[model samples]
Target: MPLHPFHGRALARAIACAIASASLGAHAEDDPQRATTLREVRVSAASHDTSVDPDLPSVVETVSAARLDRLNVVNVEDALKYLPSFGIRKRFIGDENATFSVRGTSNQQSARGLVYLDGLLLSNLLGNNWANPPRWSMAFPENLARVDVIYGAYSALYPGNAIGATVLMTTRMPDRLEVTGEVQAFTQHVHDYGVDRDYGGSRQSATIGDRSGRFAFLIGVSHLRSNGQPLVYATQALSSATGGPRPVTGAIADTGANGLPRQVVGINAEGQEATDQDEAHARLTYDITPDVTAGLTVGYWSQDMSHRTETFLRDANGQPVYAGPVTIDGRRYTLPANYFAPSTRQSRNYLYGASLGTHRDTGWNVEGNVSYFDMDRNRDRVASSVSYNGAGLLTAGDGSRWRTLDLRASHTPDSIAPDTHTVSFGYHYDGYRLANASYNLDAWRRGGAGMLTAANGGSTQTQALYLQDAWQLVDGWRLTVGARYEQWRAFDGSRATATAGVRYAERKETHTSPKASLAWTVSDTVLLRLSAARAYRFPTVNELFQGSFNGIALVNNDPRLKPENDLSRELSAEWYRPNGVARFTVYRSDTRDTLFSQTDTTVFPNVTNVQNVGLVRTRGAEASYDARDVIWPGFDLTANAAYTQATTVRNRRNPASEGKQFYRIPRWRANLVATWRATGRMALTLAGRYSGRQYNTLDHSDIHPDTFGGASDFLTFDARVTWKASDHVDLGAGVDNLTDRRYYVYYPYPSRTYLVEAKFHL
Candidate 1:
């Protein structure tokens, strides 16, 4: 908690800005259009701006409300699935608990991807742990106005754990009283398999505000539920060591010979058992002025799992056995019992902030803002089981609590002709605290083993200051330069340490990010742009100083680890025509000192160290085509495809995986979405996703085997039909996973399902 350094950095940035302004007068003025229009506009693009311009160098994609409704995307993950650069792997279908990796950075368990709701940070400030990773459950898709995806390193602007990409979710703000609702149900059948699964959910939302357009407020709530099935293939595999049939459960216990407890084996289908999920969210927004707005949100999620296999005890034979007695964390339980395992997660996030921006009459414009973010998450996992002695037992009751406070502010200068420029400086203060406690049943069962309870908690605070400037040197070319300096300190009462990253980006573009190409407006219908940039990522608290607690022994955190930095450059061109649009981009990211988990053979079960393993180089290409008002009136078609190759360029000492492929990062991914509006009140849509094979683990060991980890591909289809019953009422029906292709994605995704719903507005 030192204030001197932060103040000094701020002062230095102010002085630098003054110096730049003074020097601007002497330099040969570049194209005045470059300085006045492109430079200032590009700076706004670097941070947050809706308008798509070519001068910005970062890749950004926006999902529209109309698109959301057509796809019936209920969660944040679904909303952005069409983007070629982003991928999501969920443990269950119809569940918001998912692992998201964009541009291959989020593939690692320790990877950090920042999430924001209306500019409020949702990434946990606690030590980096998947338990507290930014979750999709915080906001429902039904309440979103739009989702903006900013790809690559953005820490220089947002300042936190933003390394791979930033997902900005903006809630719907209404200008008039409006209400909408939908209910859906569907069944999925695995191809070549007789098993068919069914699931469904419903949502209702309302927005009440005035049409005056100056002062307005919007409040909405959404609820969803589903009975999800397991995605892993349940078929058994023969073990090479014992020649015994191995069940494909991932990390769960396995049966041994004669049912006697043996070594745990591999199982594919052993993921979250049949489970029911419930989620609810509420958002309130108020527009204080035409240039400023504020909002608050609250969300709750609960999961109830039935028949979840806690442990696999073996019988006398090598065959798998379900009925038996077992002990977990020193608690004994009987089989064939409910085994009820329930977990509840809830979050309350508040944002009371405003944006003040203006275009001066003198042609000098300025934009600045200050905001406060308070976010908290509570998670509890409880297990209740029956004992062989016919006694009721609650073996494990564990819970964790996390809270974060964030404050940020930024400023942009006025645009000057031919040399127009914007210098932005900001400071961010982030405070995070976490507490976890786990209980032991053996202590209470044995009548006083001291009532075993292990607890740990810590706090961290960080202050960051950054300065960025966009200078227009010519009409078609611009330069963007910025650097961020951060100082982070963790307090365990007395012990503390600090870390920082200084990053910069320089590029020229005709449009913002992907829209940046080489094509120029030779005519009214032809335009082109091309550009590239360098981005970096910093390590999170969990990856640096996290302590281990989970039963899995291979995963461990290294306190001495350094930050992972990368140089990412992309080049692309696009053609915009009256009938359709086609764009393609080729990108490469050379990462040095990439932080990754390295297994420690020094231990029996093997521990791991989160280290700057070596260098990783990734190259990829993406193409997309969109045709609006296609052959049929009111019909639209969009198709996107991406191919990526990621490999370890250095790992001289670790031969075990020196050149192995990264985990969970597919080399190829593609999607297609089409929609047709037959009438003002009716629409039909179809969508599909495909991902190439990927490795599950770095070592490729059967114990952590690459079996459930290999390449998997599946095709799913969905369609929705809506009808306006009256001015105040509307009805709709939809089917998800229309083909019901039984497939595994990261885990088991839900099979095909159908739903029907109706809504009434006043």
Candidate 2:
């Protein structure tokens, strides 16, 4: 193997760092910019023009931990709320089911995007829905160094899931002994139909780490407790007769068209649920040689939550109504106060992984990482009926695991070709398995073997090979091209019940994804890039085998769902200066066989299942401006705007949805933030975000904006201030949704929330 011109320089730098750290009784760490700087020099050496690769053909953005701290983020989702064309449906603080959306990707399609923590996959690919969102809680904000958001599937290094977006989070590795602790308290004031009160929460965390010689170790733990507002609303049809056997709850004037008595604006029967969560994580790293490193990591998370509700309706005797009807002035009414069922849920999750990697400036560099996640415990119990009868357990036992292997080789020719070139080739393998089961129960108070309601699972495996090359064709032009071939298979697909058993046949698919880009240096301060790509995303285990159960074969597990394919193109331009940068991108995507879950109530009987649409198209543009020390020595500002129009073009299976906008995707959004360093020990920041109205159904039939059922436009404000109280102590306070903007994304979002936090470090 031959070596590049900068190979010797990179080696000398690495050796120098190693020797310096060894003599100081420490472990060597890679320089943050070493890789980028070296790659730039090598690319320009052939053209005899030395210029940095400041702007790649692809659109990528990075958010550093320092910026997160300045914003006083509350969680991993909060830290990413300001990214361009990106959003997360976070109903409340400590929400377990937070789902993210980027560009044209909707939140309901959880599998369209990918997330990684230090090269370990955190995305839950077993299913594609709100419940199967990435394990964001497993990634602690305090442990993160930075997060990179890759906008498109323009690289062979990632799978087709990157067609929507790829989020990579890198954690901090301690160079020396360190200890940190934090305490936080928060509260929100809610004012909906029946809910007019304050709910609160608290969190505490600690971390410790050290690096000595050739080994390093770190451990972190966190605990949180919260009382959240109701997630479900009670409703009744306006067309229903007033007289009924069931009791009635106090009614409120209807807001939608078919006006009828809906449940009064108040907490639902389940009321507020109190939640308790705990997380623990540890990692150990060792240097096997001067150029090789090995590491192991383990993480565990658990939750205990329970809640009970009280009805507002009462009988003649003033007792809270539980059942039966009542008459007033010869008028009869049906009340459902008796059907309020409270519930409790307990679950525990675990994650473990191991990795080995090598680094070298010249020749080949390779890395391998494998991870497994298990659902240790999952059980939910609910009241059998509205009479406060015995409780019944809903046996939902499910688990999934993914194993990934990657190997790569890259080298830059010592003797330059016609143009400077760096070539890379890699092989990848990933296997995923899901086991799901559910059971019916007779008595809620006691646990016993009940009839099996559902039992099904499936597995998906993929093997892929890819080759990529980057060439600087001339002094001011560069091109990158890559292609990947993947073979995918779904096996062990089955569905069964205690009385009847149904099985599905195995499925297979194959695709070739190609990517290309051309970048031109327009001038010393401007750069322009145009790119295009073709990608495919396969169905998950749940999408292929998880079926709804009824008396008949409605929504039978169809084993022949086709993979989704997308053709995308983008044009981007960036202007750079000493103090700030501005960037704009316009992109479009045309997708075929798009997978989505649909409600088919008119199919003789109601049935909900996942289906594929013929074609869908999306066009969008994003612009952002970032500056530091804008008007003062310590002032920073960032502003961004996004517009996207995602619509179904053709769908033979559901023609009514054609020409309608995609669900839960706002067409317009804007975000702005400003930060000021008031003093050496103090900082203050303020932010604002706005989102336009969006649809909740494929046909866009939901026109009314009710607090509980429809998506509504909203704008919110946030502010935070932090002060260094001492050398080892810090204090901070912040307010989210400062304007108390009332909005809904099918569920009421939090309003006017405040938090206070304190931190100690050594």
Candidate 3:
């Protein structure tokens, strides 16, 4: 199927319409309090320390704690929901598997980005897909001071994962005694696929902090409880079965994403889940000197989850049908017995971290950090039969853990001269061990480990050394150059079943990456920058050694797989004015040996798993406008539009993917947010998000998206209102997905949702 012509240029049309409105709606000269810094950013809105100017030539986005309070702050990820060209897989309030996506990447690619909290790595590098998302529940929204995002892999200080993006979250240290508390509640009504109901949740958080002389301590806790909407529906392709069918009603005749006929019977698999999550964290910091500080942080998170399934099909006598043959449109169909079975999971995670760093304007400075993350206890109970308390399986990950270490030093000259420069050097080490084992159980909910059923486990390690230098070439020109050398190894790869177990030999590889950035200040109000880099991303543990099995026979395991090589480049032009700033950017990326999961349609029976593709090319452009007091004294606006096109150039094993659009990446994305302050303490906001055409299959076979199992265009609007009751209290209300548009991204997204919140401070 061919794309609709007008929809292909969605970014262009959206930008044009927005510009037309802004020209007539804004008065740039109205605001007197808005500040702008062009050549050098010496003044900021926040009081936090963020002098990491290493990502000079790339586009960076920053938001302060004050700005976050105006939006719905139920979850920390909500702070980034309005950013441009960003995709987050936060299905519900307490979803534990939320992943991050940016630019040309998909939300399922969890290992292609970096997330840090107070210099501690939060990204789980054990795997490369949905199962390996960042550990974000440990950071409560009320405890953050600021958040910064750096685009592209243009800095030598970070690993190859920086090619997607780098996020830095800074926690606050109080100057005096402070206590804060917040409570929030939300609800959403979903009506889709013969299922209609209301799902809702609630959250509560509190933080206490104080500073006494050279010592400071902070403690925070938060909890969430939610009932999510149905995420899966049972369906079977229209087939010719040679058997008499039982008459059943409520079976929906539908077409699949690929235009194949199917019957939608009921919700199955990961149906509706009731989630309860709790997290606690504490931080202690001491100032050895006025410019030197040491800190220790401990965080713990836990989740107890269970599920409930519902059926729509019924027999002739009005009895609900759980399984067996049924007739839909005179065609015989059989619903699997285990289709509506539910599973339960319990998870306990802990993170301990320490950091020692110096804060100085010039001369030598040193910093050291180390963190350890462990899955203290984990169990996933899966049922094989729908019968009550029947036999099942238990998967345990009790010994899975990861460790990280970083040591860095930097020197800055006192003055800007021909020989003056800022030099930074660092050494980094990271290790991850995955230990997962499954055993047969006598009962689903109340059962112990019985016989060995299946197992998959592996270990990965990376060590790197890097150096970078930034210097002023002339009056208005600055240049930066750097390189990183890394050695990656994978070992202790093993898989097992009831029969036997097997281990893979150790594998090791070394690679060097180069990076550069150049910036030229054309004038006080304009600047131009160019950045280029080459990154090598090593395969993760699951991608290297993990495989599926069919009755003890090995399948889908690849021992010989190469790393991914990516060459990325970007150029940007920035304009500054009294009210705000505007920027235009273009970027391109060429990659080889790309690690991804795709189904080979050329084969007789489709096989879906992780594989390496030969070549992929992606290019895009973005335009952004951010200004405060655009029309009135307290009016602020921020908007951005982007266009991206990613295509597969070559693939030897999966030829059907060549010359087709890459999976899950939309061709266009746009966002808009505006705020109006009615009084000194009252504010109202309106926000919009858009995503254009996307495909679920690499061959572009999933046409007519908007059905289940397809990646479709997404567009939604959000609004929020906040009022300061007093100097120590605040209240807020908001709505998301105002139109309740029906859409899909392989799963039905949230429908019309309502929110209410209250906060107190002393």
Candidate 4:
């Protein structure tokens, strides 16, 4: 069946608003909690909420469903954009996939962040980096209840991988039997110089579930489609030295024969693409006994995508040449072979998992989970190349398939004293396999008589043991200490690694990290916080085992690179009042063994290598304020600002390169959000975000070319409107990127767009 398309963010916002309206109404009859605004605690930072207090050693942020709705955040990447410390880059290579980096620690070529769904690891085991474009589409956006971002490394808690940050997502639970759905449409325009082009798409989702009497179930489906705009580029011959066309044969023939005549030809930019997604989830709870409870959850997801494009060939005179009929590998071919799509690619994925947990008053809590995932991609052409055999056309084809399994268990103690103490521990295991099996048409058409297919597969197994202790040392004073040990092994391949960390925190006005902090409650309305700790991040699969491909150039992974480590410290102060809240924090990180892509001149087209380059230092500060109670009932306003500076301290061949600013690391970023409740059942909100100019590449060179360098600055605005129609029903509408400004957060991002949505609940 053909896939469907829709604007993801618009759909999510509409659904969130409807759910929020229903939840609020259901609780209106009960007494509401006091409005003593406090930063929400995040489970991803640690295994439990004992670390929720701001006096802890880590920096954490939480995005609730209500906030997501207000911002029209549809995917995980979009949700993280709200955090000033996080950066995202979406490219045309992977439509549904985007890249995420936290602080300045991310590996631009391959993502450095770790992803978890309800505490289950989503990192690709066959490779080190998290999957490109993230597997976010695996779950319907409306299913997300909250997202937890834990900044800095928590090797002791998460082990081996905790580097720049860890993202954890928790889906919502049905409160009662319910049915909900949403539909949205959007249009976009991209104008280069005076030429103008238009593109647009639509999306829809329907959900049915029952949440009552300890039993809940939810099933949903979502789809999106778009007619993409064409791409333009300056084409050149393969070589200027060789004047005549070289023999077009062998594996490298598609790149144009060594001396092939080349000329600039306008490429067609017309094509259509679509995606279809479906999901099913269920949760069961039983009060095994008065003090004990058991819960089970199961979920499944699937997605399918398809796209098509056109191809062409130019002659020496820079004009179209009727190459009649060319034949290769016993197949006949034509210039505009209906099969060639210049910018065509397609992929599909299926995921499912289940988990069980038990809670008891005996001061003991235990949970176990297991999951499976499979993904596949098919391409009509290997890349932008074309081939011909004696018979006709032999389009190059490629396919990738992945399968994974994961298991985890955790246990926490039940009770203690006023100085409440708890020790928690857990274990995790993962397995993965990837296969590249497709016909190499180019290889055969060049003279090779046999079919060619490149096939390689590998697996990885990792184990971690960690323990943490939380102690309320004294009134207004808290202490946390923890450590973890991790080991990883690759089968059919060769490599093993291990690592560890410790942290401490104190509540005081003047605090020092990596040392001590002293917080004094000078008054009922004032308090101080101080903290310090050491953090680190290990290398991922892509950095160590990935092979090179042709795009920017050839590249290879170096398995010899070591893990990156850091020693960090931070200080902060906060003030709380009946009507408002304010906070400020300053932090610095001393990082060593940073990884980067290095060139190898020894090989033709020099292959790129991943290496531990040098030392880096980063310092930053952030301030925020929010007012609600003092501004009149039903009204709230919040503003936040941050500044960061990062420099390379040392490197291999160029010690002078030290002090160079890190690439893609913005110096200033900020945001503001305001909301007004016109009535008890109606509300409106506005939000604005800004990012300072940042260099894209690491070399910091404008003349010398490198993949990572460029500069960009952007501003975006969004608005939302909501209405409570009745006790059980609500409606909402929203607009994102309201200005429809054509810009790029990174190169090749989609241009300005508009979206509208409608949601219903029963």
**Candidate 1 Cα outliers beyond 4 Å, as residue runs:** 1-55, 109-111, 125-130, 186-213, 231-377, 382-417, 441-452, 493-536, 549-555, 578-580, 601-605, 700-711
For 1-762, candidate 4 gives per-residue lDDT tens digits of: 111222323333433343333223232221122233222121222222221223234556666676666555444466776574666664431245455765666436343566666544554434433244456655566777777776665324554345567777776657677788777666667563223667766677778777656555666766655444443322233332432331221111122112243332233322334445454545454545543334454445444444433323444344433333433222333344323433333454545565555544345656665666665433333323333333221222122323323322333334333466554556655555444333334332333222433323344445555555555455555455665555554444322111211111211111111223334444555555555555444444445555533443323656556766667666666665454446667878777887666554335665557767578888887665554532456665556667778787877534445677776676666666777878988878887666655654455543211111124455667777777777665566666556654443323345555556667777
Please give the distance, in angstroms, between residue 164's alpha carbon in candidate 1 and its true position after superposition.
Answer: 2.2
Candidate 3 steric clashes: 0
Tens-digit per-residue lDDT, 628-647, candidate 3: 77766688888888888888
TM-score of each: 0.73, 0.89, 0.96, 0.74
For residues 232-350, write the lDDT of model 1, one tens digit per residue.
Answer: 33322222233223232222333321222333322222333454445555555444554444445555555544332333334445444443443332334333433322222333444
lDDT of 1: 0.50
**Positional deviation of 173 in candidate 4, in angstroms?**
1.5
lDDT of 2 at 592: 94
Question: Highest lDDT, which number?
Answer: 3
CA lDDT of each prediction against the hidden true structure: 0.50, 0.73, 0.82, 0.50
Give candidate 2 misplaced runs (Cα > 4 Å). 1-57, 243-249, 256-261, 265-271, 307-310, 322-338, 361-363, 387-391, 412-418, 442-449, 552-556, 600-607
* Candidate 3 segments exceeding 4 Å error: 1-11, 16-51, 417-419, 600-607
lDDT of model number 3: 0.82
